[model samples]
Each structure stands twice: as C-alpha cells, then as structure tokens.
Target chain A: MDRPASFLDEALSLDDGDSNNLQPWIGRVVLVEDCVETNGAFVLHHLIKRFLSPNLSSSDSIVIFVAFAQPFSHYDRILLPLGDRQGEGVPSKEAKRDIGDMDWRDLVTGLELAWVGGLGFAELGCNLVVQRENKRLIFFDMLMLECPDDGVEDGIIALYGNIQKAVEAVSSLNKNITIMIDDISLLEVAANGSTKDVLDFMHYCHTLTTQFACTIITVIHEDIYSSADHFTLPLQMEHLADIKIKAEPLVTGLAADVHGQLTILNKGSSDGLGRWKSKIRNFHYRVKENSVEYFYPGGRT
Target chain B: MATNKGRTSSFSRNFSAAPTSSIPGLKYGPNGTIFLSSGVPDLDKILGGGFHLGSLVMIMEDTEAPHHMLLLRNFMSQGLVHNQPILYASPSTNPRAFLGTLPTMLVSKDDRSRNTDAEQKDLRIAWQYKKYLGENKPHIEERDGKVEYCNEFDLRKPIEKHLIMGNRVECISLLDCSSLAGFRNSCSKFLSQLPRYDGNITSAGRIAIQSLCAPQCEYFDKEWDMLSFIRSLKSMVRSSNAVAFLTFPASLVSPSVSKRWQHLADTLLSVKAIPDEDKELANLLTGYQDMLGLLSVHKVARFNTQVPVILDATTYSIKLQKRRSLVLECLNQAPVDGSSGSSYGTSGSCSGSSKTGTLDF
Candidate 1:
C-alpha cells in the first residue's frame, strides 16, 4: 500500500503521537503573523520543506516565492540543504553525507523565486538560481523600470502583469502550486504605503488561488504598523485568510525551555463549508540546529 | 409607401436630432436609477443607493488622525473600476501611493475564455449586419467587431500592457496644488479637459480634493481666500455633471468655519476615533468588543422629503471586520446590563452594571 502524498500529513504525524486526528492543508490562504520578538523565518522554512518533501508524490508541484525583505541568496541558503550546511561552516564531505540522510535536497527542487524592488538582490537571486538546473527566477526592479508619466499606476500594472505571466507559464504543469509572499509590509512600502493597492493586489492573488487551485502563504510583521490606519491592512488580511497562524516569543527569556508559541486557527475546514465551527490550536516550539520541534505548552504530558 | 415615409420621418426626428437631456453626463445604474456607486456597496446602501449626480460629498476627519482617507480611496477605486475619469487634487498625498491603493479586479479563467469567445461572436454578427446595411454604418466606435463606450479599467491587474497596446482611456488626473488659487485653477482645468461623451453615451467623472483647507492654511495669507475657494468649488460642482468629494481636517479649522463648509455640501459625513474611556467602557460591557470608531451622517440631500430627518442624522459604530469590509452597526440605544451579562457571563454582569452607572455622565 502507498502512503498519502502530503507533507502536512507527514509533519503532523510527528506531533507527539496525535497524528491521525490532524487535518491537512489543501489549497488555502495561510497568514503567518510575526512580532518584533519572534523570527518567523524558521517556521516558513519548515513549511516550504514540507510542501516540497519527497514524501509528496506529486513531483510536478511548484513553489512560487516572492521575496521583499530578504534576497534570493538568503532564501536559497534557508531552503537548499547545501546552503544550510555551508551556513553552519560544516566541511563539504560531511555536508554531502548529511544531505543523503535527509529529504531537504529534494524538497527545494521545484522552487521559482521572484525578487521585487532594487536590482541588487534581484541580480544576486538570478545568479544564484542560474547556478542550479531547472530552477526558475523572475525579477522586477522598480528603480530600473520607468514609471508611467502619470505616476505609479502603470508601474503597478506592469508588476501585476509580470506576476500573471509567471503564473500562466507554470499553469500547464497542473500541479499543486504554492505562492509565498515573504513579507507583505515590504510590498506595501514599495507601493508607497497604499493600503488599498496592497489589499487589491492580494484580492487578485486570492482569485488566482481559486482559479488555478493554488495555495497562498503570506508573512506580515505586526510590529511595523503602529497606528490604527496602518493596522487596518493586516486586520483585513487576517479576515480574508482561511488559516491564520500567529508566532510570538514566550514571555520568558530565550534561554527558557519553551522558546516561542505558534497559534494556528483553521478558519474553516478543507471544503470551506464548515466555516461556522472553526478550530484553533496552540503549540510551544523550539528551533534546534537543523530542525524545529513542536511540543505541548507544559511538556509532553 | 405613404406609411413607410411617415415612419422614416419619425425615426430621423428621434435619431438624427441631438439628445435633449438637461444633464450631459448622466449614467444609468443597474436599477435604471441616476446614482453613482460610492465604491463600498454597504456605504452605497446607506447613502440611498449611492451619491446623486452633481452632488458634493464632504467627509470631515480628525486632523491628527486622518483615517477617513480609506473611504476616499474606496470612492476613487470605484471610479477607476467603472472607467470614470478621476480628477484627484491634493498637496500632501503621493500620486504613486494613491495609485497603489486601488484594488485589482478578479479575473477567472472562465471569464477570460468567455470574454474572448463573446468578442469573436460579436464581430461575426457585426460583419453580417454591416454587409446587409451597406454604406450607412452606425456612428458608434467599433473595434474587433464590438462597440465599446469607454475602455474598462481593472485595478487588480497591471495596465501597462493595455497602455502599450493602445486605445485604453487615460482615466486618472493627479494634481498637486500648493496654494488656494492653484487648487481652483487646477480643478477648473481638469474638469474642462474631461470627456463629456463616450461615443454619444453620456459619461461622468469624479473629482476628489484631499484636505480642502490644509493646503490653504499652509500657503494662503488670509482665511477669506479659503472661504472664497470653497464657494467657487461649490458652484463649480453644481454646474458640472461630475460627483465631487471634499475632505477637511476638523482639528485644523474652527467649529464655525467647518460648519459653513458642512452647510455647502449635499451630504456631510464625519468619522472620529472613539475616546479611550468610552472604548474601555464598551469593552467592559460587551465581551467581544472590536468597534474602533464612530461615523455620523449629519446631513443627506434628496432624502429630506422621502425619509425622516431623524434617520438621516443617525450615528453608526464602525467595526472593520476580518473580511476587510467595514461593518457599521447603528448605535440606537444605550448599553444595558442584562444583554451584556448573558453574553459575557458573571464577570460581564458585574462590570456592565458599574459601566451603566457611570454612563449618567
């Protein structure tokens, strides 16, 4: 008998013997809310790995990653096993052996990276992706591109058009596509803090999820927005998302056994018909050297 | 032959002659009503199915906290979606940032396929008709076998491709005016340049002025100039077929000056952040409290005869929900203890009673 091809299935199975009860994430919008005290990169990395894991039989599945806060090289290091080992200053020989023992290498094979904003990072991302075979890269540098004489509307239109083209190019594969926007706040800044424009852009992205049967994951830092006006966008997005996951550091110091908390609110079931009764779960997690461990709040119990 | 001649004369009289409608740019809604969409459907519902043509809408907001800008964005966004030309005059707002605030139109695969299929079918039918009519082509603008009134604008997508392809209507005009005179001049120039007709079909445009007096307060040497500017602006709006929105910073101006401006507008709306003490009281009374602000509709034109004045002067507690839609619940009655107690349990009952006692102030 064959196992189900879902990284969420495998990942949840490792959740302290509460495997069979866990629900799988199909095509949905997941919001990862991060605060100043907590870094959500590790959780995002884990999510990407789960989506790309070899256990998922769908080899054709694609991952479209839009980077704003970080460069391609930064993501490449976080995603690829080779880059991960190199970051650790491990010798090349041991890194090769470690790669064979894990599924991380196969997990990043289907990544398509996009860089928006300055050309410095986009160029760097392009070069990095080009070194690897079958990897796709797209870049939109506002500095180099001439905006319409009228103003930013033309530029925004161009940016959206490029994204549409990229999505269309991969549509033929008929695979489970996941579009991850690393940080929406950066995109808002790039758009000159126009809350409406950003919200509208996300609405279009939401449309794509239904039209193409794709999943979207967006990361937003709550700390960036202080005023009520600034807070509205994130609040609006939280309402729009199907799944809301908030990550914040524990009140105790980082040296404490439990480092942070991950609150997952499944807004609705997989079918979306069961929205009236949604489920919310919390887990205390710790980021180790090469992996992350999720445990109950007060030990295994 | 005698009957046919009579019919021909009647057809020519109706078709060949100019349209005698008094309003030049009147757009008929889905319900065949002469109303313009406020962008947010909920708002449109509240304002008696949208703003009446040639009426001025004035939004007053706290000078320190100008959150009413979001409503203005929604108004402008609706205009763009309907392909209505917008004349945006502001001194502080960045054009790029303003453009960025528009929401994109959702385009599904089915819609794309259906649109293309429909276009091709329309072309074939038009060609056959043209062959039958022979030489007397209609005055309508035809492209790819279909007649279009004006280019449709989709905020959800990038417009560069449409611009590059040509024939897309330039819809937005951003004017950066520093002085009162400059603002008036820009408004006149922008309004004059707007197209009155889209191939014989009447079309309307939107004029939005951000903080009418803020710029004047900074640049104008006298307050009378600001008052005169508002007077001219009111007359201009009344004369033209365009719907105008003017926002004022309440904190910057005196009560009497704002009252005068409010009197000039057809519809007057004020949005203010709830005070901290009231918010805490509300939270204590209601277990789940997220309402952030209060919106008051001081006056509404055209509803003076049809609807009661009391209904027009209602207050709504504004709650921005998770779905991004602004929910405005009418604040009709004072908060009572019993209802709050049942929803919040024992602790809620205790706090609710205390809050109600303090409500006498």
Candidate 2:
C-alpha cells in the first residue's frame, strides 16, 4: 500500500534533484595555536556544541597536558603536597603521588589510550578535577600531575612526548578532540640555554598539529612576566595557526576591574569566519583566577 | 424739437446699454462673438479649434480621373491672413498648360439651393443605376469637363470671390509644372523664384503636387523607394515653415503604395467618389440621368488637432454621389476605419483619445 503523503513530502519533492546529493561538511579545519586563544579552544567549543552534540557527543572528547618547566630537578615536590600540615588531617594528594611514580614510557602509553582519567580517580572517577573553593583550579590540577622518577629535563621531554603521541593517535582515530595549552612561555624559559633547543621546541609544538586530525588550542597571556624577544617566543607556532584571536585588556574603573576584548583572524579554508567577519567586532571577558566570565557581545545563542 | 430729440436719444441709450465690468482691449474684445464663433463651425470642430498661426500642416489625396485642386487652394485661402504662402505642384496634370480643372463654384450657396430638387431626384437615379451595375461593374458615370478634356474653366474668379478678397496676397499658388514631360527644369526655376516673394506672399502659400510618381504608375513598380523621393521634397517645405500637400491617382496605385505614401505624409486623406446606388429607383428614369458626376468632397486627416477628427465625403451623403461613387466607397473601405459602427457616422469623426497623441494611423 502506498503511504499517504504529507505537506512536507510534497514541498521536498519540489526541490528533489540529484545535485543535492553532493553534501560538503560546512566546518573547516582551522589549525589553531598561539595568540590569546592559544589554540582553537573557542572554535572547538562551538563545534562540539553544534556537530558533536545530541548526534555524537559520546564519541567526542578533549585532552590537555599538565607539565612543568625543565631543569628544576625535584618533580616529586612539584607533584605532591609539600607542606606538612598533618595534624590538621589534610590529605596527601593522591594524583600527585601517582604521577610522580610514572616513568616516561608510562606517560607515552597513557597518551596512546583512548582516554586518561583526570587527577584523582580513587575517590571519584572525575574526568576533570576541580579543587573545592580554590580560585586557582588550573594550578591545583598542574600540581597534582607531576613526575617522580624523572629530572626536570626528563619530565619536560616526557610531557612533550605524551602530548605529541596523544595528538597523533587521536588524529588517526579521527576523534573530534580539541587540545588546550595554557601557556607557551614555560617552554621559552626551558630553552634559555640554547637557540637550537628553543627552535627545536618551537618547531615541535608548531608542527605537532600537522600530524593530528584533532584540533589544538593554546592560551597565552598578553603580559609574559619575563624577558623573551619576539623571535624566541612561540612566533613559529603563532604563524602556523589558521586562526588567531587576540585578547586585550578592557578596563573600566579602579579596584583591579578588567575585561578582555578579542580580535580574531580567520585563516582556514572551510571556516565560517568569512560570515562572522561582519558580525563579530569584539568580545568581553572578565577573568577571575583560573576561570573567566566570557561575554559575547551579540550573545552566542 | 428739443422733446423729440430727447425721446430719440433716450431710446438709443436704452438699446446700447454698457457692460457692468471693465473690459480690456477692443470693444467686446474678451467675450465677443468673434472669439466664440469658429470661422467654419463644422470645420473648426473637426480641426479641434480654428486654424492658428505658425502651424505646420500637410494634405494628401489620390486624384479621380479629373483633378480636384481647389480644396487645397481654398484651404490656403484662409491660411493667407497669417501671411502664409501657398505652393502648388501637379506632376500628373499640367496646371500651367491649362487653368484650374476643378470648378470652385460647384457647391456655392446659390448652386446648393438650385441643386436641392435636383439633389433628391439625382440620388434616386444613382441608387437604381448602382443596382443595375451590380457588384462587378466598374461603377461609372459621365466624365465630362474633366481636367484631361477641358481646355479652360475660369476657376480663379470664383476662388478670389469666395476665398481670397480679404486674405492677403501673402497667399501664393504655385501650379507645379514639374511632373509633366519636358517641364522639370522650368518648374525648378519657378520654385527658385519663391524665396524672392517670401514676404509679398502670405505664410499661407499652398503647393499641390499632381502625383507622387514622376511618370504615371511609377508607384506600382517600386513603392517604398518612390515614397521616399516624395518624402524628400518635404525638406524644402520645412525650410520655410510651409505645408506641402500631395495629390495622386486614386485607383492606379496598390495598397503598399498608399501605405508608403501615408508613412511619409504627416496628414493623409482620400477624396473618393460617392456611389449613386445609395439613393432611389424612379430617378434613374428621369431626364438628368448623369447628375452624379465629378464633384468631390474633401476627406481630411485630422492631426495635432484638439478633438481627434477626420472628414470625408460621408459628411454629406447626397453631396457624396456628385463625384465618382466607387472611389468614395473604396476610401470608406480603408482598413483604418474597419469594423466601425454607424453610431460614429461615416467620415469617421470618432473620438479615440486617452490623452493627446498622434492618431493611430
């Protein structure tokens, strides 16, 4: 029996043509790194909300690295809680202990796995751990994941290897993952000894995204708080990114009140930035410690 | 004596009472009958209003066997008051070898009154005669005193009496001798003398050309090209702000020739013969059997006039039969007025205007 047709079916029939079969994905692959967005963290957030949502949210994931600068030599002290405030019954952080015990081989293998649980999984299997009532939540996570069997140099190499492996493996799996880097200057400091080392490190970070299908995001602050010339800074990384969104301070009054203004550049082929050029003038963000209140002027919704 | 004079003066005062309002210019100037009255009321109405100074005009008609030049000559008569000169040319008939072929006195007031009883009987005869001919016969009549046969007819005397006594010699009549064989050079020389009389001749000078083609039936050979040559002569007319009227043979040219002629002509008209058949039967047996002869009524192409109008033989039906009946019926049969209802009257004075523009010719 032929099914009765609806108004929608009739309307669709009018536009029925073989040309409609050629569907191209509307989103473009934008290599994001450097600048204040650090990477395509913002664009990735949007992609997840749009394409990966109700349709494929379970398959989508993001990865981040928590590491320290080289040559300091006490990875244990960096990872675990250093102060002895035992009588008060403060817990000796479990995540820092676990990280300090792992070797370079374990780190690389952990990155190869589909997912790596964040911080402490003994108490609760939280994909991400946020310290209760702590304004420096990012700093807390960084402190809880450190190398114990490694020197500062080995620990830096181990972290870098893990990041490269993770990006490459996820890209192979074709997982829609976004990688966020909080800072680039820490590597700048690690390469203070040699120009070749700095160049190598910069080249590695810049080209790492080339091997990965997953998008990478790096966040950097405007004020570096250290002396590094433009060439030594992540200039190579900045140049390779298909997009760069710069955050400038927009301060109104006294009392340390400040907001961020974003200047975005689109460099990707299939990106929707061409359309957004007319709509987005600037964005306002109020940064408090590790988290920020981002105000999109037009309201993203 | 004083009382008698007082009474007479009082009667005169009562008769010539003055107007209440102050009138400017001449006596009875603004609201006078002179302003209200059209020179020829019916003609003025067909012309939208009375003739005005500085109007460029043209009149064209295909000729019957005997020519009719007086209609154009009389039109120029009224035009003379404005100091307009008339230039007349006859390529088909030689006007210089002879005088006016058409009788100007045919429809005069005295002649009209005399024609009244004759008109009634003449119509009855024409009607019965057409019935005898049926449809196939060449509708014919007596072709006497034609331009081709007549040596002289004193036309100027009556024309001067009826049309030109008061009108200035500003009126010029050029009887073009150019169209006849061996007369082209002479006619050209005569036209060259026109510039000298520009002022002595009134602005109402009328020139009549006998035919569009140089030789008889030249139009049937190549219509469009011949019409262009005829149209080229209009430049000479425009140079002096004068009107050029063309006259051609009515029956000889083809339909295309008429169209080409009309394309060049700013105003076009056809003077056709009125068929005698439209009247009655017993008159055919009467003494004056050929009363319907060569007396034509003017068919005008009304252009640039206020009330879109055209007038031909049909305005006066009884008068129409005085000319060749076949030619008039052919003129009536022109496609321009086809499918017209009788409510509009023949000669087609129908109103076809939204705003003012050219007639849809």
Candidate 3:
C-alpha cells in the first residue's frame, strides 16, 4: 500500500511509501531552530509521532526522547487522549475531539485542513506509554538536571553514557534508533552556559551517528544568540545539521488561522530513488490539541 | 479562526466540565491544571484563567516606575484573603513592613445596581445549585455562605490587621540572604510546607519575590548565579502546589539573561509606564488620561497541550475604576475619527505605546 505525502513530508523528503526498505532520515542530524515569539516544540512533537508511527518507518525502530524542557506527561498526552486511562503515569489527556481523519488531498489544496495532523498519530493513535512498555520508545526526564559549576562535563558525560547504553541495546536487535533532544538550549542552561562542555557532548553524539547509523534531531532558539557577536552555539548547531527547519512568528504577527510559519531548508537527502536535490520550502502551520495542521500561506480562507 | 471554534468550545467546557472541589481560592482549568487567582479580577479574565498552580509568573518591571508592585500587592492580598500560605521576599530590609500596605478586599460595590444583580443571582442558586456552582462562575457569591475565591481589592485601603496576623504570612529580607542560593534555600523551606497531591490539591500557596535582581541585592552582579537560581526555582515550583511571582527590571540585567528569564517563566508579562503627557497617544486612543500603564502578555502557560492560547488582544491599558480599585480595559480608538487601518502608522511614533491596544496584530 502506497500512502501519499503531505507538504511537510515532501519538504523534508521523507517517504511514507510501503516499498521503502531503508529509512531516508537515518544518520542525519536535523535541527529545528525557533524564536521566542513562536516555540518550535510543536515541530518536535510532530517528529516524535513521525518516528513512532509504523507507517513512516520500520516497526523495529526505537525513539530515544530526551526532554529537557517539559515532563513525560507533556509528551505522553500528545499521543492520544486516553482519558479513561488517565490513571496511568500521565496526568492530563489530549482533547479527543480533533482526531477526525482526513485525506491527503486536503494538504495539497491549501484548505484549512482540520485539526488533526492527518498522518501518523491521528489514525494509529500510538500511545507513548505503550511504545515505552514495548521497547519502541525511551524517555529521559531531565527537567530536574542542574549541573554544578565544576561537574558540568561530568553530568553531560553521564547523560551521553546512558544514551550510548540504550543505543547499544537497541542496535543488536536490528532496530533503527533516533535520538531526539527537545532542545539544546536548556542543555546549555543546565550546564550554566558552559559552551565547551555542551560542544563536547554534541561531538560525542555525532560520533554515535557514525558508529551505529542512528539519526539525531535537536532544537534550539535562534533568536537567543542573534545579537551575540560570536554566535558560537547556534552557529555551531547550524553547521552540524544536514537539514534545518526554522519556525518563526510571521513578520505581520500571529493569526487565528495560522500559528506560525515554518521554513524547511533540506540539504540533499538520499533515498531508495536517489539523493533529492537541496530544496527550500516555507509553509504555515496551526497547532491543535492532538496534532498540528500544515498549510501553505494564504491556503485557507 | 473558523476552524478553531470547536477547539475553543471544548476549551471552555473543560474548565467547568471537570468534577472539581469547591476550593475557596482554587478553580479547575483545562489540562488538569488548577488556577490560582493572580489577585486582580480583570487580570484573571485576561489570562483566560489566573496563574495555574505550580507556574512561575514573572513580571518584567518598568525601571522608571514601581508599577509591578500593583500586581505584587494584589497577589499577596488575595492569598491572605483566601488563607493560603504566603512567603514574600523583597530586597529591602523591612520586607515585613511592606505587608501592612497590602490592599484589602473591597466589600462595598460602588455600582449599586451591579451589587443587587449579583445578590439576586447567588440567592437564586442558594439552595438548589449551590453545591453544583461550577468553577466557571468565579465571583464573590454568598450562596451557602462559602468564602469567595477571588476578590476585588480597594487599592487605597490597607488590609485589616487581623487578616494579616491570622494567616501564615512569612516575609523575608533579601539582605538576609547573601546570595541567590541563600534566597533559594528560603524558598524551598517555605515551599516544603505546602506539598502537592496527585491530581488533588489541599491548598495553594503564593510566593511573591519583588525585584529579584534589583541593584541593592548582593547577588545583583552574579548574572549566571541568578539565572541558575531561577532555573532551579522553576523546577522546584513545578513540583509543588504553589505559584512563585517574581519581578525583575529587564533594563538592569543583560539582554541575554533577561531573555532566558522570559523563557523560564510559565506565564510571562511586561508592564511599561505610560508617559505623563503624550499628545500622540492622547489623540490615538480614548481613555488616555485614565491609563496608568500598559500590560502586554508575552506568554500564557500551556500545561499538557501543545496548542498556545493566542488572545484577540495582547496589550491592555491598566486603568483604575473611580480611582479606588484596579481595573484593566482594552484600549479602543477615539470616537473622534472614523479612520481606517492606514492611520495606525501616523499615530505610532513611540515604540512602547505604539501597539494598537485592541488590534490582534
């Protein structure tokens, strides 16, 4: 069975087709940079659901979610609103009313696509808890991580060791792995802005991609260092990523129909067909309770 | 806007629809979040609900004016009225004395007609629906003689001594704490008293820290230490059933540190003092003279959901009603001219007040 692609999937050149054996996004470092006025967390949520959804990748895949921003409860409820199962670890639930299914043509027509992101989580409803229980998802709650002045490197090294151990366990099972960090900026804050130690952690993570062919995705706020003369962290992150997705508040401002605009700059990515040429596409998105609707500018009435 | 109708409808229903306790000062909001009043009635309305329990509410202070005190006063007073534990920290040595200046609840409504209307509504539901009064009907109602959750305060009047003496109001001087670490220790000691229940709350506490990075404090120059303190404070407050209200002068600290504080705040707001005499602002909007300052909402805390609350208007002119109690009103265009959107440019000369109050953009 062949599934059509949304504008976002095409923008990132991620194929959802059935015949694809090798994943297109493996061994790539994808960076999502956002500003203060608009948070890029929704993009991270979208990517989480994308990797966990079986249609987009192999069923034997694992997603290592390291969240330094919000707790597991925040990401847990985004999967599906199992209000009846509220007794579980997650306290709150997503609003269930926005889970109506949609056809892929809705994405192309630039219509105000309904609340559901219309792809993975909408139909399959992959519960993060279930995924974690079945060994398909790994969540590390880092909200309470406060590194000391001298032990900054030690703390990051501990985290890197944990991730490497998890990667090792999954690799032997012939499972593809994706290590996702909700944000790297908070990582800096936890380290008290020790850039060198944070850079070391990134270098080690980069080595993991070469070692196991695991993909890594990170998010950082570009505006934080926009005025800095050196621009070390954001510049280093931009240079490291194979593809960059930037979410920005509209120059005009926020709107009811459109939450913010996302610009995807895709470097050449290899696939079953061939390496797609580097392309750039800008689209608008509206975040909903269960999913985020992506549409082109002026696509909706 | 049209597509969001269903989401918005469900949003409001989720607030009142949940089975919540008749906690005096606590109301159940969406996403399993309980709202504790920010002390100001109009502000509670502008923020959809008041500050959620466990949220770090940061106010970017106007360096030239003590406008942020208006918010701090109401916040402390509301907690005293509700009998919630309050731990207030200020840079001044006489932090305890500041509690005497807290505003008391306005018992008398100057608007007689509105007073009678509220009485009739509460009286109608006294026997039948008193127990079923949802959290949505947030008013000072005497249905079963239950204590009101939120109160309107008379800014001119100092709180009654009994109200201040009877409650668990703890005040600490920042001078007592040499560094932010010491200050953080005081916060943790105070927060340790009010533990949180899983999806259930016994009582909510209020922590108000005034001018956290003011020059007088010893840790004023320790920017990284202050940032780390805030970061630790954020994680601490998130686990307990309390709201930490901190105000810092954005102009005093470096811009990068200020930006980090904004990001850490669950609900971020900035207050800018209006000019004493601005002819351009006077001509551009109605009620220019009554406007005390402008409050712009930078962010609203989103708990479990990813959807952000995009308000129709972000900035509102802070005004006082009859110069007695605090009131917030959305600034409207002056009735003098029926000009279209093109005229916005001509009036917007100053950067602070340039934002058209009601315009969403």
Q: Output the number of the lDDT-best candidate.
A: 3
Query: lDDT at B131 for candidate 2?
Result: 39
For every model shown, the clashing-pair count is 9, 40, 0
lDDT of 2 by residue, A91-201 (tens): 324222245544432332232111211222222211122221121112212311222222435545555677676566555555544444433433333332233554564
- Across B1-361, the per-residue lDDT of candidate 1 in tens digits comes to 2443334234433432333243332323211124566665445545554676556788898666655776776676666655667777665445444655554433342455357547745644633453344321211111221112112223334433332223222222223434566667766666676654333334677888777666434553344446556655655654455778888886566544454455456677888776656655464434225666667776554310111122322456666543344445444333464443222112223443545545544
Estimate, for each residue in B4-121, the C-alpha lDDT of model 2 and write its tens digit.
Answer: 3334334323322342122211011100110111112223323323322212233334344232343444443333322333444444334433223222333333454346536644
Candidate 1 residue-wise lDDT, A1-301, digit = tens: 1121122223333232433221244458888887544556666666665554433445455667776544343454444331121112223232222224223222222111111111112221112233223433343323222222244576555666767777788888776677788677556544544567778888888888778777788898765554554568888899878877787767653423455787877766535664475667777776532345567677632
Greater lDDT among 1 and 2 belongs to 1
Over 4 Å off, model 1? A1-301, B1-33, B105-178, B195-201, B215-221, B275-279, B284-288, B303-313, B332-335, B339-361
List each candidate's DockQ score: 0.01, 0.00, 0.29
Per-candidate iRMSD: 30.0, 53.6, 9.5
**Chain B alone: TM-score in each candidate?**
0.62, 0.43, 0.82
For each candidate, give its TM-score against the true structure.
0.38, 0.28, 0.84
Worst 10 residues of 3 chain B by lDDT: B137-146
Worst 10 residues of 3 chain A by lDDT: A104-113
Quote the lDDT for A3 in model 1. Answer: 22
Chain A TM-scores for all candidates read 0.70, 0.46, 0.81
Question: Which scores better on TM-score, 1 or 2?
Answer: 1
